[model samples]
Target: MSTVFDIEQKQDSAERLLAVADKEPRYILFADEFNKVARKTVESAIHNIELDFSWSKFKNQKQYNVNGIKQVHLLRMQMKESWILDAADEVWLLIDRYKPKRTIGTSGKLKSSGFKHAIYPDPDNPKRPSEILITGKDMILDFGQAFYFKYFSDDAHTAIGYGNKNLYQNRSWVYLRFRLKVRKGDKTYYSNSKGVIEMLVKNDYPIGKTLDYKLV
Candidate 1:
């Protein structure tokens, strides 16, 4: 009978060793350590931009009219294409796995007319029954299935609750707001590049605080 204390001690030792190994300095490094840090900082900023855009696209689905909003534009050319392709691949993979009989959006927007599938249980009608519900697993499966249906169809319209451009722009604003909140004590001095690097140094590499904080 191994005691619980022994098990805990073993786990703790393993974790410490792993952390030490991860931090071990490597020789013959392809890039200078400082250069690596600078590169990673740029990569993270690009990722944040992509995430901001994705969140915006999700929000646009909720708006009734999207014509008034400025068309979503990608400022960084190379990063923009990479983000779109990665997003499309993720959606494609999800669609392949779930294989939903029919897909519907939040506002009762149906993906296909002839396809037959049961709706998730309605909260208002507690007695109603279906194969799907609003749990986390079901949501994941639904996204995968929905992606496939839309990608394959010639007349596939945007999924419900996410088609409006304004929704995405508002989403981008919200993402920027929260990021600034986490990075800076005051919102007035939030520059996407510098703020993020400062936050990372504060949280991850405190020793690197003396380094000049710049994206490139």
Candidate 2:
């Protein structure tokens, strides 16, 4: 589970929550109900879950207010789930669907050290030969923050600059992206930290989804 709220993503949808408060007064009730439900869901999930460090451990993390409530529920966001807190009289889902764009042919070398921090060697693929994952420089900047990757690679990086040659010299890095498409009236960008947007995994893909892709 993520320790922090994706400020970028939260900020994107925050304006929506704020702007309609005055006009749609019931929206406040909707938000409060949503928060209450989220808090209960998270509290129950935390109580049942057996993690080394429990989510309840963050109870006193200088976060909750005197009323003993988080400004925004963490568990729902951490679980990548979003509920429609308030719907207009004529509610219409501005459902924005996105899928990963498999990008290949881009190339970069692995970091000399500390790659282990980002590269999570999959224990399930124990017998598979390890490949040094060469990704774009900033591609993994948010590895530990947003999502944990299951790297099938190892610490052995190839020397591709000038002298030594390795079979990986010809290999390129592969990553995924959501093909960008801004809605007609969407002024706020879709991000986790700032927007009130929901980022979720696409489960209905034709190819089988990997088990490791499950989030908390």
Candidate 3:
């Protein structure tokens, strides 16, 4: 229900654009030019933004907030190692009940340590799958199935796994097409220091926001 005049007022007061477009369209013209750019993010002041907060009451479901956008995202099982590294905290750890997994970025062969069993390096060199570290139910800290990982160098960012079946019978690998994250208080985080991630959910965070805004 926004008009040309309303768009002009919004641009004048609250819209802090990241870059000036080549074509400086007018209020209505700019609004109409939404699909012209490859990828564009429009900004609005928080005070001027309207949102509805709600959630389902199922045991498996969690609570989350809705921002200017409509679609809500959930915690995906298959994710990249970089995401865990950025979202985890100092004390947090990635939890996998049956077989714990860790992700590292490495150019050469990756090494594992500090566990009871012998380390199992990946078989396929080209398509490296989720490699399990040498650990057991005994290695499970007070935090339970949350397994903590330490990196040798920095480039060892490769590995992530989640699934519970017969260990030596049949193993399945699923392709990851989504991003998972966490929410603490009013913040939604995509990555962390210790790479600890849970099936938690978050919304409208700067990392997930459409347009990155700043004080004008």
Candidate 4:
């Protein structure tokens, strides 16, 4: 085990490296690599759903309110328009595949994504079970899935389906979630962009600590 002094020194060095990475354009390149992986992950998840997709079954379900949060704008799936609901269910299923068994006292009462991931109550909407509990490696998949859902709802161009010539053509929706953006009196830093890139480079890249950090 390392001593406290050594741990502190390592943390300080990491902080310094992160600070320097913020100014470099190569961070963007790293972010690009991460984004590519994200895209493939999302695509793979979508592909799995499509393999057995039953557009006909979706056509039978009545119109339903799919919105999980009341605070967010309300979204409803109109009659015979189950595409959004299908996609959302797929997201829930992916989360279920990796989450641990249901917590004690919560079994059988909670709704499941059908993949066995128990749905938890949403603090934002008590009546709607939208909150999903996840940790560790699954979080990245969650982000990508959530990103895809958000964009797909906003713009059908991102919809994953056969016969759409423009399918995945405009993938800016995927990249947008990782981009840094600023508004009047407010700025948001997206961690999956630079922060994750730094961590991946440090831990997974062969260059290790000797790698030259720069932004393109």
The number of clashing residue pairs in model 3 is: 15
Model 4, C-alpha of 18: deviation from truth (Å): 67
Which window of 10 residues has the lowest lDDT sum in candidate 3?
143-152
lDDT, candidate 4, 1-216, per-residue tens = 321111111123456558667576665434446545654554443333221111222323222222211111111111222232333322222222212223336455643322222245435434423232222111221122221222233323231221232234332111111111111112111112211111000111231111111111
lDDT of 1 at 98: 14
Winner of 2 and 4 under lDDT = 4
Q: Output the lDDT of residue 215, model 1.
A: 20
Model 2, poorest ten-residue lDDT window? 84-93
Per-candidate TM vs. native?
0.16, 0.15, 0.17, 0.17
Better of 1 and 3 by TM-score: 3
Best by lDDT: 4
> Over the full model, what C-alpha lDDT does candidate 4 score relative to the true structure?
0.25
lDDT rank, highest first? Answer: 4, 2, 3, 1
TM-score order of candidates, best first? 3, 4, 1, 2
**Residue 127 in model 4: shift from native, Å?**
6.1
Score residue 69 of candidate 2 by CA lDDT: 16
Q: Write the per-residue lDDT of candidate 2 for residues 1-216, one digit (tens) a residue.
A: 331121122222577767775675654545556555644443343233221212233322222221211121122112122221111111111112222223334655333421111112546433221222212111111111112122223322222121122223222121222111111122221221111223221222232211112122
* Model 2 score (lDDT): 0.24
Better of 1 and 4 by TM-score: 4
